[model samples]
Target chain A: MRLISLTAIAAITAFPLFAHADDRIEDALEARHGYMTMLAINMGTLAGMAKGEIEYDEAAASTAGANIEALGNYAVSDLFIEGTANGEVDDSDALPAIWENPDDFVQKFADLGEAAAGAGEAVKGGQANVGPVVQKLGGTCKVCHDDYRKKD
Target chain B: MAEDQARRVRIWDPALRAFHWLLALLVVANWLLGKFGPNIMTLHFWLGYSIVALLAFRLIWGIIGPESARFSSLFHHPRSVTGYLRDMVKREPSHWPGHNPLGALAVIAMLLVLIWQVGTGLIADPEDFVNVGPLANKVGSDIATKADAWHALGADLILIFVLMHIAAILFYRIWKNEDLIRPMLTGWKWVRRR
Candidate 1:
């Protein structure tokens, strides 16, 4: 009877740790999702203007570019903590390959930051400059997404 | 007498040849860009537009092009397709200057699937509401979602069909001693007079 009580106590104590870890993972996933969504929103605006699908409004482009550039400056490594890779969380598009090749994955983020900076500068120069810079910026996203993100 | 011994025929016209190779190149390049080139949707959109244009040309050409390139000349009845398959199993396949029955089916299938693929792309919206197709905004969110799903599924189907098409060409080359690819490249094939 004493042994049974001890086992029950251990189970009760261990449960919270698991729950806490899960909660942290969920938070991380939510943070990353918001980060990507913001990036996409900014990207879409720039892309629409670049393609002539929308009228080129310099103010809007500059604002979007600054947003992206700022977001790029974020320390994204913290946003993708342990247990955020695929299979660990629901709706995570991150592949295990990101963890497997940490250096390359991190390098892609660095590239994205650089490209975002270029985009910010290009937007100030107006339409012609924005297209190529946005292309470069998008390419960085593809680089990370192709290798590190899971396809749906 | 020596020249008469091997009769060579021009089966594929220059326009058809150019269309075939250009389409192949564009498809491969666009796929790479789609898979690996992010934010380069400008180029991606242009590539897709080119593909749609080429497909449109091909469709019209298939209707009114040369004798060998016409759909009426290539498409065969189901019985003929089944018969060709049976003969292929026996290692005694028939020959045509243009696509054979089975090859014809593959060509038609690929063209139709690609048309569907490009059509879906015209209305697809990636990332909820961002980076959408040109016509995506005109359609509602539900339709956009359906188009996106079909676009994703269509990409895989295209890959499968392309691989199978390559495998079939290789199979014919090794097993039946046919040079299907060579004819496509050179637009000429040696035909035996009956």
Candidate 2:
């Protein structure tokens, strides 16, 4: 009877820890995934406006560019970075290649963040200044996606 | 009497066959349009709606359709799928008439994927630039953005699966002489010796 009670107490104590850990990982992944995808999208939107496919509106353009730039400050460690090598979570399309070639991936991310910051500056400066900034930002996205993002 | 039984074999139903080819054509066209230019996006939307409608009809039909077309008739145990795979690898004769286990799983997976994709697209907003799904406003902007991301990813995965499926068919055709594509196109299989 004493052993059974001890076993039950241990089960109760340990269950929540495992559950909490799993939930934390999942929640973190979802948040990071949502943020990174938004980064891609905001960049794409700016590029679209610059290319004339989308009409430029002052408020939306400024907001999008600022959002893109702000994403650079988001802590990379908050993301499930370790899983890119193992596919633990499908947060990023970033393949095993990202970890295999870590230097290249970090460089690309840095370049993307830099271009985005520039784009944010340009958009904040004036609508007319954003086109060139967007072009630079868009180019980085394509480069990273082509090299790091797994096809299909 | 045994020879006469050969004349009675029919595999897929007419509606099911029509749905299969039409969905295939529309899916391919949609992929090509997304590839080529943004101009075909309007066509892609209509085609997507059509796919949703076809899926709805298929879901209903699968319940009421002929024995071969019914879901209950085709879906088999995982062990059966393993056996089927083994037979496929060995080029052994298959006895079951309806969709083989692998094909049934593929069909279900395809439909489920399409459903998730189109459903997510309904609430997706691609920054309101060239494309925003019909029901984007229904969801909050944050949710919509997330859904848009999923929609794009789903489409990409679908493309991957379709390519894999085609490759498998081709492999079967060339390596095993199955001619799997022709039956979906023609709704008729070559006579097999029982």
Candidate 3:
């Protein structure tokens, strides 16, 4: 009877740890999605003008480039915490290869930050300048996703 | 003369030989560019279109081609394929006027797989919204994602089939002492007089 009670107590305490871990993953993914959404919105602005879908406005181009450059430098380690890859979290598109090859994954993001910084400086000139910058920045996305992200 | 029992005959059409070498060069280029040269995506895109064109041409030509080049020439009875395999295991070779059974399998399988690779590649979207297939805009995001996965898988399948093909060619060269590649190159092979 005493052993049974002890086991119950241990289970009760450990349950919270599991729950906390789950919440941490959930929290990280939520933050990641929010961050990604912000990134897409800013990237969209630059891409639109670059593609001539939206008429080029110098002010909009400047703001979007600055935002992307800043977000590229944002500390993303928390969001990519181990055990938060796609198989572990159903909704996450982060592949296990990301955690396995952590350095390469992180370096890709760093490369993006560097390109974004250059792009931020370059787009200040005009729409013609924006097109080439967008192309350079866009190449980074495909290359990084080629290794780290799940299909799609 | 003993040599006159069989003679080199023009069998594979000039069109077929051209298709064979051109597709081979383009496929190798496409694989290299697609795998290693991500920065040169325009070249990759153009090569991919060329491959699609070759496949489209092959599909029609497979029907109306010469007797040796026609798809009908590739069809062996099921028992014949197995019998050929049984003989192959015993280190014996049977000369077919056109493709040997295993060669036929390799050719048809490669065609289907390459066709599938281009089909999916045409519609896939990686979702960065910047890098996408030419036809990506025609499909919903969900469908595009599905095709993207298939496209990736198709790349792997192509590699496997190509390796298998090379292995088969080597097997013929080293084990069977058959110069299967020569016919494709020169559009002629030594065959028994019909």
Candidate 4:
């Protein structure tokens, strides 16, 4: 009975993301940008705390880190819908390389999701501990962008 | 001293020579850092800043440094530049105490292109919003994008100018038996005194 109730709660929480997993979602370019912006915001908060630009607050760190973990694992395929790459659409920074090398693109996020999960947990430690993990999370953001994002 | 050794003149000064080699090393190192190790932003930015410092010194040196390092030495009249090019094609090695006319043009182009490269780098950013240059936040994202394009183009231009510069040195070394590289190091080149 207890295990069944725990599974039901987990399913209820995850159902929303799964429901919106439509591959042909509209305004995907904007959607993806919005998603990335959110990640960046949370990332900026953690980065600020890590760089001591913002005072270290444990609760804030934990929230931002967990937010990154959840966002990183969110279904990304729909957000990268076909024909939304730069030049194909207006103001798109999404490089054609993303579509050309879809496997590598998919793999990068998969790895980032895993890394974000670890970073999310590692950052739960006090002030001194968050810096390195924040850097690691930033690296995950960079490695993919370094390859897949439009440079200019 | 040997007859040819006696012909050696103090054309390049010590400061200019050191500046040449140090700038060369730093440019190569920084270029490699940009091309191969984009992830190494801290080191790359630090080296670039070092290049900017060296360039600043060079600018002052060009103004008031030795005759060899002066801006006056670099700008040959149009006729002289054309004549220099004409002589080179005829395999006539016209020797100057400082940069030869063709080399001077190459130097000017190189310095300009390098300046553009580093200048654009100040505001350059990938659209991905990575933690980047000092002026990344100062400019709008569109401007940063434009600068990034120029930055990449500038890098290629730098490489081409650098290659041409080296090729010119090698051409002099083998064909004309002129050791341009050594003078940059030793501050003296064996040239006809009269």
Q: After TM-score superposition, what is the CA distance of residue B16 in candidate 4 from its true location, in Å?
A: 1.3
Candidate rank order under TM-score: 3, 4, 1, 2
Evaluated on chain B only, candidate 4 has a TM-score of: 0.90
Candidate 1: stretches off by over 4 Å: A1-15, A48-61, A118-122, A125-133, B1-18, B29-45, B65-77, B89-93, B120-133, B136-163, B170-174, B181-194
Kindly list the per-residue Cα lDDT of model 2 for residues B100-160, writing each as its tens digit: 7898898888888989988987887655233557787689787887886788788788998
Q: Evaluate model 1 with DockQ and give the value.
A: 0.16
Top candidate on lDDT is 3
lDDT of 1 by residue, A1-152 (tens): 99999999999999999999888898899989999989988988888788787778888898889899999889898789988988987888899988999999889999989878745657876677667767777777766765787645
Give DockQ per model, in order: 0.16, 0.05, 0.49, 0.22
Candidate 3: C-alpha lDDT? 0.82
Which residues of candidate 4, in runs, are more than 4 Å off?
A: A1-26, A125-127, B1-6, B127-131, B192-194
**Model 1 captures what fraction of native contacts?**
0.16
TM-score of 3: 0.88
User: What docking grade applies to model 2?
Assistant: incorrect
Q: After superposition, how far is residue B32 of candidate 2 from its true place, in Å?
A: 2.0
What are the TM-scores, per candidate, against the unseen true structure? Answer: 0.75, 0.55, 0.88, 0.83
Model 3 misplaced stretches (Cα beyond 4 Å): A1-16, A118-121, A124-126, B1-4, B89-93
Q: Any residue pairs clashing in model 1, and if so which? A: A138-B38, A138-B39
| Per-residue alpha-carbon lDDT of candidate 4 for residues A12-52, written as tens digits (9 for 90 to 100) | 99887866653234368778888988888888888778767
- Among all windows of ten consecutive residues in candidate 2 chain A, which has the lowest summed lDDT? A77-86
Candidate 4: give the clashing pairs.
none
Quote the true-contact fraction of every model. Answer: 0.16, 0.00, 0.44, 0.34
> Just chain B of model 1: what TM-score?
0.90
Q: Return the interface RMSD of the candidates, in order shown, one decimal each.
A: 4.9, 7.3, 2.4, 3.2
